[model samples]
Target: MSAQKVLKLSDLKQDAAVRVVIDDIPIAVVLDSNGEVHAIGDTCTHGDISLSDGFVEGETLECWAHGSAFSLRTGRPLNLPAYEPVPVYEVTIDGDDILIDPHVTKEVN
Candidate 1:
């Protein structure tokens, strides 16, 4: 498993999202409202809008373009306009650093 260091924990604020690229993959690193970190595909499945540009409530990240809400843990769209789920990555926190494995995705059903 090739895991890359994405960002520092201090670089992300609580309840915010950041767009990152790793090995040509656009990822959305989200600091959820519960103070937990999650990593998922930045692109919305229904639209081309970036998920990082949307609002995050609890564990759901809403797409700003079409108001599609996706779950941070599973990448599954909880609302309409998007039936397909995005890719969810595995995040590892090492001390103050945040590591992400772009090749490794958390399976969502």
Candidate 2:
């Protein structure tokens, strides 16, 4: 499947996260502190919480419920309370739009 245009680049502010649904999957589109964009699974692995409601520290998104930190790039859980990694989607920046492919993910190692 092709990448779907999820959001406009201008709508996403720095150090903020937005929840978007594509292909029935909930995704969290984040603009980190370094001005880089990332797309990760919105659901926190440890708890039934939205990661977009959590905090963004650098490249990691912390779960608001249990404080599990997930890597934005690899989707690997960095902290405790969550051992499983969430899905990380491939993000494509097209002009002023943010495109995301839910089928593609960065390999977690």
Worst 10 residues of 2 by lDDT: 100-109
Q: By TM-score, how accurate is candidate 1?
A: 0.96
Colliding pairs, model 1? none
Off by over 4 Å in 1: none
Q: What TM-score should be assigned to candidate 2?
A: 0.95
How many residue pairs clash per model? 0, 0
lDDT of 1 by residue, 1-109 (tens): 6899999999998888999999889999999878899999999999888999999999999999999999999999999999999999999999999999999999866
TM-score of each: 0.96, 0.95
Question: What is residue 11's positional error in candidate 1, in angstroms?
Answer: 0.6
Report the number of backbone clashes for model 2. 0
